[model samples]
Target: MKKWLIFSILIMFGIFNLNEPVLAEAGAADLTSEAAVLMDTQSGAILFGKNEEVKMYPASLTKIATAIYAIEKGNLDDQVIVSKKVFDIDGTRVYLNPGEQVTLKKLIQGMLINSGNDAAMAIAIHLDGTMEKYSQHVNEFLESEIGVKATHFVNPHGLFDEDHYTTAKDLGIILNYAMKNEDFREIFGTKQMKWDGESWDTTLLSHHRMLKGEIPYPGVTGGKTGFVDQSKQTLATTAENGPLKLTAILLKSEYKKKIYDDTIKLFDYGFSNFKSSQVKKGEVFTSGKRQFTYSADTFLTDPIDEGNRTVDSNGVLNIENREGKVIQTVELKPIIKKKLEVKNTAQKAEQSGVLSLNSIVGGILLLFAVGVLVLNRKQKRNRRYRSR
Candidate 1:
């Protein structure tokens, strides 16, 4: 009996573990390039890519980090001086001539929108006393936030330096992280923006096909474009449609147009390949308080065995996942009935099993006690009859 009890307890443990919800692995991507990636903004699902981890010169793509750092350490309205060193920066200048006055905010717009190498230097000079210190700041950020093992930097502008290099995968990750910030999303998405009495726009409007209505994607929401004769035409582009947000990063395309073609193709694949399904809502779900919902076809991997799920009309849906283990319960202060209805509706189209373990133990205990009583009675009757 003791051995049987031990075995039963072990089986109970197995049942408990079996009821846990298992998570699925991330989805993979398909793209043709030296490196590339696509992901659902909210889901963190990797939709597609090729050679994503290969390290290469990021060129002006380096400005994404520069832009992010400036946003954090420098205020938008803060005044910044354009050092003589910063004003003379070659390649993609926001046209910052020597002694030119500009606000930190407008400089950021210049840096991001124009891919200004000089803006990077000016912002760096102001924040850390020098661009070198600012680069150190970016390096520390890379280690803490990006978890990039192979990335290093020598400049904020992403000009090719032997010491400056990053993996395509890491750049994609940084882009995603940056896009979530409202400041970044707002800055990178604009086709044309002016700051501090300085005008900035996407370089050479002829380069952007979206401006010409060439790509069918909703429109370019925001992103940086990159190139080094050696790095080829490296492009990072993001687009928004109705409910979806997508980003693509490509390195070293053969033709300039290839950058545009590849970006649009990746976006098309994401928007076309999967339907935007709402998996969860962050809100408490009051009045409209459903945090999570499943479609009619949504079947719980394990179904509830008993109790059609009871709510005291408080709108709390109490559901048991087959093992009498509750999987989901929501209580909304304003309406508990609505919570119950949602719980019931979620389980409606699904067939589930009944809860299996409660009464068995109770029945066993009762039977054992009864047998002990009967045996004692028999022994007492035998003793009494013998005495008589």
Candidate 2:
């Protein structure tokens, strides 16, 4: 009777609280896309990912790279004579007629805003001379400049090619790089633009639903959408709320709405769970007698837990979560003091070698100066002897 009375009292106190169960963080994202990635654009940290590294068709997202490449490499004012080859390309187009002329800037705007295949081909052939050469140059540029690994391009227009493929993470990498350019960012985020082409003179409208307001989402900064029979529906979006800037990439989604839904959930997860944080430039961290300072101001978006963060002897700051997975790794500069300097003597040996080289060069220079002085003195004595 006492035990039963105690149980009843515990229930009344709401000790169980089964109706208001707390959801776990890992399972919070309910995504249906085959592959997706959400990243903090400022920090390059992955906020949420599902098969992010898995290789898949990027479709028109390839133009994000092409647009930036052209903006940086081509003279925007130069008139490109429309070639017959542009009309030969497949998929969406701005309907450029052969022998018609258009500015590089206008073609870029049309290509990005309207998903114009002909514009892409025109830019490629005009800038790089050939479609085959354009692919090689762009692939190399993406790998060398943007640091993308799991992507390859066969055509600038992103026509279905078996060899052309990229991952969600790679697309995020390309978008992050492209967004840094003011020119590319302006066109990338543009929803509508007037086109006075010789063949098709109409306003080019963005196909991205969120960017166009077809799908209402707050803080929609820029977006790109693509679909092909082999690639399915692929989307890329960028948004900023307060100090947080996020980029979400969805690939191979069977349902178009699923991509948008997954994007919203990803953004919500990032904004709700993560926050902007910084380890100020020159903030000292002590390990034993040695001290290390962050070389530059680094911004972070992961959940802050100072205790879970560690600095190694090499001056790398590693932040880990409760599950022990590494969330971010930042490079730091080692601040050597009189007492703490000896701890990293082995690492400083390279610097010492450089000093030694400088010392050797200085000694040789001094010897050369002394030789010059001695020669001058000898010459003076010879002249004096001749005078006597």
Candidate 3:
């Protein structure tokens, strides 16, 4: 009986372990890029990372920053005169002549869609007055506005400047911030555009294979590709599946196709294993004595098995997976409920009433004592007068 009972207990333990959903061994495999990152654009969660913070050359991916900066700072309707220095820029060109005049908007399209170094130069010169000034301005903008620390730029056209470097993680940060601008989003996702420049009149096509549909990727919204001897092959791609928006960054890949392959793997991992989980606006969560409600729908990319999220008194929500790894942090706006305020006031009033009653009783007792003493003194004085 003892042997049979022990065997049954062992069998029950095995069944219990099998019933539990075991978390797959963490991290992705077989990515070829030297550095890669997959990020949820909505929640800014790094789903997968491999040397993402290590600095690498950005190459023409620098144009991603230049395009948005020009759109924000320079007037699109303003005509930019192509300087002679623009013609001297190395790599692909829109064949701009020294005195050619092009609108700032058209130049942005050429630079982004056709990867035109000439157009990039004209835009930079027009915006910041000189390449040196443009480089400084863009670097500051990247740090201050986009919150990217691991990035630096020396030129608007991503020529191989030794100082020009960025990390895959930083690129994802910049791209996510840039996508918020309506004008930038339109230009970034554009697959092709017509060029009416003085030297080149052909249609400009985006060099990014995924964006151009040369390489089909599901739900591909936008992409940018970069290459140089120093940077090797770098690619940034953004895609949306259902409510989840994802950005994938790959840098310093040895082979060109390897970048695309890495991006696909990142996307698959993000979309398949994770989902956009939302805590609706006004959903209440308690932290310590304070209760906080979601100011807006807190949309987060979470693992499918993410059990419950907790909000702290600091108004930060922690989304944790089943394995208890915190995957996302959301800063929520703290709400003040009128009922709670009223309750606090009522409690204060009750305490105030107790204090007031104590004061009244003490004042009454002191007044009665003083009256009794005065009366006694009057009686004593009357007795003395009558006796005399």
1-388 per-residue lDDT for model 1 (tens digits): 9998987898877854654332211222323356777665543345565767788888888888888777876788887877889756778777675566778877777777777788888888878887677778889987787566778887888887778888777887788778868898777766665344444433423224553356545756766778887787777877766666666788877676766777877776666543333433333332334233222222111121232343435556454433444433444333224335776765653423222334677788999999999999999999999999
**Candidate that scores best on lDDT:** 2
Better TM-score candidate (1, 3): 3
RMSD of each: 21.8, 12.5, 8.6
Give TM-scores for every candidate, taking all chains together and pairing residue i with residue i: 0.61, 0.79, 0.78
Clashing pairs in 3: none
In order of TM-score, best first, we have 2, 3, 1
- Tell me which residue pairs clash in candidate 2: none
Candidate 3 residues lying further than 4 Å off, grouped into runs, are 1-27, 277-283, 287-290, 295-298, 333-388
Q: Model 3 — TM-score against the truth? A: 0.78
- lDDT by residue (tens digit), candidate 3, 1-388: 9998987898777843544443323434587788888888877887778888998888888898998888878898998888888867889888999988888988888888888888999999989888889989999998988799889999987788779888888988888888888888888899988777676678888889989888789899988888888888889899999899999989888988878887887887778778886679888777777777777776677787555578865779887766676778877777676555788899999999999999999999999999999999999999999999
For model 3, give the 10-residue run with minimal summed lDDT. 18-27
User: lDDT of model 2 at residue 325?
Assistant: 63
Summed backbone clashes in each candidate are 18, 0, 0
Q: How much RMSD separates candidate 1 from the native structure?
A: 21.8
TM-score of 1: 0.61
Q: RMSD of candidate 2 to the true fold?
A: 12.5
